[model samples]
Target: MKRITLPLTDEQISTLKAGDSVLLSGTMITGRDAAHKRLFELIQNGEKLPVDIKDETIYYVGPAPAKPGYAVGPAGPTSSYRMDKYAPALLDMGLKGMVGKGRRSDEVIDAIVRNHAVYFCAIGGAAALIAKSIKKTEPICYEDLGTESVRRYYVEDFPCIVAIDCEGNNIYMSASDISAPI
Candidate 1:
């Protein structure tokens, strides 16, 4: 499987197409409902966000606490559409990727096309299985945000799909039509 880091450049996005299987490694930030809400407010006010998003990929998750020596607890993807409103704004800031389940609004999809970003989705509720791939986790900021807080994960070969490409194409939204679950 191919491995990539975030802030996917035009070259990377251009090379990626639907059905491309990848394992994302590097710093992936976790944010769900609570964090997404806070991020929206930060964007509207032109305030500095808790983390630098230059080329960051946000993971929509709230993992369980890690066991001793484990990088993180059960890690799983959450409903991605929840952050639809905030996604467009962040995309404007050079955020090139998002990971979650479910379809977001057309506005979010349009913003993605306009900004040349893609969406990656992880297997939902498969936290323990997913956590096996994480090598480390560190609280970068937003410590008090609870599990909804933003944390950085250094994952090794975390399985993923290029659900949405720069061309404004998506799979999960139409997975029911094109492909059956593997």
Candidate 2:
């Protein structure tokens, strides 16, 4: 498996391809549907956002509360489609990567290609296992949203698959083609 460090550069993103297994390390921010809506609204209103997303990877997850000795609980990837509406805008604003489960919209894929970004798929049922990679969690904003609050996570060796690469190649499409009736 390829190991990647966060704040991915253009060279790194360009080298990734759909279906590549990777282990990501370094910092990434977390945001779910609610937080995304807020960010979208801010952008629409021309107001400054609370967080700087430039060159950052946003993971679509609302991690559970931490256990006694842990930084976070069973942190898992959330369905990515829900963020599709806001994704293109975010990508335009310099967001480079996204981590989540499931497929993304066509517009999102186009934006990913246009911006030379990448989308990774985290295993859905491996929340507990995923949580082990996160070394620290710090609240960023939208705290009132509770678990859906935005946060920053410092992680090491976070496992994921390149579901969609910079050039718009998608593993989901390949999978569908393989399963389609001839």
Assess each prediction's global lDDT (C-alpha) against the native. Answer: 0.83, 0.95
lDDT of 1 by residue, 95-131 (tens): 8888887777888889889988888878788889999
lDDT, model 2, position 14:
88
* Model 2: residue 67 alpha-carbon error in angstroms: 1.4
**All candidates: CA RMSD in angstroms?**
3.4, 1.7
Model 2 accuracy (lDDT, Cα): 0.95
TM-scores of the models, in the order given: 0.90, 0.95
lDDT of 2 by residue, 25-91 (tens): 9999999999999999999999999999999999999888887998899999999999999999999
Instruction: Please give the distance, in angstroms, between residue 163's alpha carbon in candidate 1 and its true position after superposition.
Output: 0.8
TM-score of 2: 0.95
